[model samples]
Target: MTEKTAGKSLGVVGLAVFLSAALGYPVLIVAGRGLNPADGAVFLAFWGVVFGIGSALSPIEQEVSRLSAHADLRGGRVGPTALRTVAVAVIAVGVLGAVLALPPVAERIYSADDISLGLIALASSVAFALQFGTRGVLIGFREVKPYGGLLVTEAGVRILLLCALLVLGVTGLLPISVSVALGSFAFLPFLVKARKHVDFVGDAEPWSVVARRTLLLMLSAGLTASVLTGYPAVAKFFAAKEDLDALGSLFFALSLARVPLLLLSPVQAMAVPTVVRLLQDEDGHRRLVSLLIRGTLAAFVLAGLGGLAGWLIGPWGVRLLFGDQHVVAGWAVAGLVWSSVLLGAVLLLAAVLVARKQPGRVLLTWAVVAAMSVLVLAFTPGDMVLRSVFGLVVAPTVGVFVALGLVVRAGSRDTSVTG
Candidate 1:
């Protein structure tokens, strides 16, 4: 893509993200209020299910699109049946995992708050999966407008629906669950509209090849999800039951801190297909990589500055946005915010790996982070100080180091074409 085109794409993505973030804060405050200490655990558990399933399915979508584009560019064809079948299987696994995991865990490990949040998670996972699947197709085609529109639509609808539900006294677990499910399916209309702009239909390919590729994608996606979401979940696991409230508060703070990173997700989203296409041309690939790194660095620096500001004024911000009840989470929020800055930088490395189709390297890097996260949590004392120290400070710093190492190693590898 031309620099001008890329700049336009970036601008669109940034606008979409900023809009989502602006809308998200109020919605999160409302949602967070609906969550009590008991409900928080269930919410986290539910989130775990959502993340697990969503993660597993993500790679399938990414790989399918990547492979499909590769095939198309090389004058080859991919069977639509093969693609749809793999997608169906992925959906099946995700649905099954959510159903099984949510019910049992909610009954056993979760508090009342967790129970409600868990239900919402279960419902939302389906939506998350579908949105992600469609997004992959859009990215593969380098359709930035639809991709940005879809995100804006999802976030906007979810917020509106959540507000409407709250007004209707449907703020309980069951209602929240229904709302989540509705939100997940709400993108169908948009996807349907966007579908006409791209082609995903064709004859079926052999099931064996489809199945194998899908499985690899699933594994890679799952590992990536685990690394991303597992940190908070693991922190909760290490925390005491009575201290669940504080932990939940910390998780909320962390989520808030991640807002900036979440807003910039569209950058990475747009980068994937662009980078993939550029890989075919040596100079283009280098330029694309350089642009992505520079953008990532700039984003990280901004997030860090935001984090510093949050540290200085986080309590006031928390009080103003989420109310005084949640103000105790301020310090944790500040710490987690800075941590997100580090993690955002790490995503650049991840984007590079994705562009290169080096899922194995991505998997290995996350595995190391996961191991270190577990080790840190295991050794830390069960207190707010320890949790904050480990979860906020140590874990993210270690992940940044690991991500940097991967980026360096990836940089060192020969970039010659191999097909």
Candidate 2:
């Protein structure tokens, strides 16, 4: 895409991200207030699993976006490739469903016998795949307006459904959970509209290549989500039984601290394409280096400010929103916010590595971070909240460094092609 076109896409997508972020809070607020502490804790764990899987499976979107953009450049159709991707995603979801259906896994994750949640989880997976696949198509074709609309629709419908449930006094876990799951499916109208786009029409990569690369991307995304979207659920496994009840506060604080990520998510969706476009430019390497330096600086500055705010306001913020039942210490809030900022930076760097076609490096980076976090969570001694905070703060710090190193090395060897 031309620089002017890129700028326009950024503006539209940025606005949509803003709207999505704003609309999203009501859903969280309602969820926090409507459920008692124990139920809220259970629901938060459920929320983490659903979103974590969605985030983990986001590679479908990323791969499709990358493939679609390259296909467009080659004057080829990515429609068939997109279809194959959906099939692979379906198969993956089937496996995921089976695992989640296990009594052991379901009992721990859901903390309730509600069989409906299992069904909702499966359905949500399908919706997540379709949602990401459709989004990939729009993004590949540079359909920013439609892309932006999809974002708003998903968030707006979620808030509306959740709020409606609240108004009806149906704040039980099942109803609210279903309401949350429906947000992924709210993109149906947008999907129909997406079908009319010309980009999904021609021949592209072989299925084997797509599947292999997609699996690698999925692995990387899964590890990343374990910390970002899935952390609460993952934490439940390692956290002492006594600490689990109190996790409601930590999870709430973490969610609030992650607001910036929600707002910045749309930008992340565009990261691979933006980096790919840069890689295709004549003076790409130097430009990529400059971008990395600036991005690192920006991440630190923004994180520093966010940490300060969390330290001062986050303690009272959760209390005000969810009552005294949930209260995270200010230091923990600040640390979580800092971790999120670093995680965002790591994601951007991973995009650069992906654009360079270095999936192994990306996978390796997240693996290290994930392992580090899990070890800390398992072995660290302290209050559960502090332990959680330390693990989160340390993991992403490692990811940013590892990913940056990988990106730099990849750039040094070859910036113009898959290395």
RMSD of each: 5.0, 3.5
Worst 10 residues of 2 by lDDT: 410-419
Decoy 2 TM-score against native: 0.85
Winning model by TM-score: 2
Candidate 1 lDDT, 47-106, residue by residue in tens: 555556666676655655675556556655444653464466556665654654464454
Stretches of candidate 2 exceeding 4 Å from the true structure: 1-9, 66-78, 113-115, 142-144, 196-206, 263-305, 408-413, 416-419
Q: Candidate 1 at 109: error in angstroms?
A: 5.6
Best by lDDT: 2
CA lDDT scores, all candidates in order: 0.60, 0.80
Clashes of each: 7, 1
Worst 10 residues of 1 by lDDT: 410-419
